[model samples]
Target: MSIEQRVTEEMKVAMRAKDKVRLIALKGIRAAFIEALKEDGSESLADDRATTILRRLAKQRRESIEAYEQGSRADLAALERAELEVIDAFLPSLADEETTRAWVEEAIASTGASSPGDMGRVMGALMSAHRGDLDGKLANRLVRELLGS
Candidate 1:
């Protein structure tokens, strides 16, 4: 089944199981998917689009968690972490450090990126190659390390 279909099914399962956190996250995902479909005039989102949406949701949750922690709101931080866990259930397998490093090397080679000056080109290639499988911030860090900048 497609990612969209799987998410819909998961939403129903969450409802049946009375999983409040999962249900809320699923609803948010469904709403985002619907909004994207409406905006693009498409019946279903492509896999890449779905992955992108999930990643964006996860990123937002992480940011919220960080902010909550900074504000000394543990309860809100916990909630954001729960939501992040639910959203992460649909994401592609995250790349490990070794894999990320390998991809960074490949990106550098493929883009002929020799110095920090080519960081943008290298980052663009890496993001395109590893989207949904790697976190953008982590990827950027790895690229920077590889470029020694």
Candidate 2:
């Protein structure tokens, strides 16, 4: 089944189990999917689009967690952490730093990015090839390290 369908089914399960954090995260996901459908004027969301939405949601939660922690709000950070866990369940596992480093090296070689000035080209290549799999910050750092050497 598609990610969207799986999410809907899981939402029902969460409701039945009275999982507050999962239910809240799923509700937010469903709402986001509904908004995307409305915007696209489609009956359902494509899995790729749904994945993109999930990634965005996950990123927001991570940022919130960081902010809450920085402000010395452990309770809020914990809540965001719980929400992030729920969101992560639906996302594909991200590439590790080593894998991303390999990809960065390949991107540099393929793009002929010999210096830091060509970082944009290398980054664009990496994003197009591995948009959802790689961590942007990690890939960027790898790119800089490879190109700067």
Candidate 3:
């Protein structure tokens, strides 16, 4: 099933089970999907787009958790962490640092990225090929290190 469909089904399950955190997370995802569809003027979202949206939501949660923690709001941070767990359940596992390094090396070689100036080319290739799988920050660091920057 498409991610949206899966989320919808899960929402029903959450509602039935009275899972407040799961329901809230699912509702947030549903709202984001609806907003995306309205922006695109489309009736359905591709799985790729759905994954991107989920990733974005997860990222937001992570940032919020960090911010809350730094601001000394333990209760708020805990809530964000709970929401993050629910969001994470739908995300595919990320590639490890080692795997991301290998991909970065390959991208550098394939793109002839011999210097820091070629970081953009290498990153563009890497992200296009492994958007949802790899950690972008790790890949960027690898690219810079491999490029002797």
Tens digits of per-residue lDDT for model 1, 1-149: 88899999999999999999889989999999999999999988998899889888988999999999999999999988988988888888888998888999999999999888899999999888777787677888988898889
Question: Where does the lowest 10-residue lDDT sum fall in candidate 2?
Answer: 140-149
Worst 10 residues of 1 by lDDT: 128-137
Q: State the local distance difference test value for candidate 2.
A: 0.92
Ranking by TM-score: 2, 3, 1
lDDT of 1: 0.90
Better of 1 and 2 by TM-score: 2
Better of 2 and 3 by TM-score: 2
Report the candidate with higher lDDT, 2 versus 3: 2
lDDT of 3: 0.92
How many angstroms is residue 142 displaced in model 1 relative to the true structure, after the best TM-score fit? 1.9
- TM-scores, all candidates, are 0.91, 0.96, 0.95
lDDT of 2 by residue, 1-149 (tens): 99999999999999999999889989999999999999999998998899999999999999999999999999999999998898899999999999999899888889988888999999999999999899999998888888874
lDDT tens string, model 3, 42-124?
A: 99999889989989999999999999999999999998889889888888899999899889988988998788999999999
Task: Give the candidate order by descending lDDT.
Answer: 2, 3, 1
Q: How many backbone collisions does model 2 have?
A: 0
**RMSD of each candidate?**
1.5, 1.1, 1.1
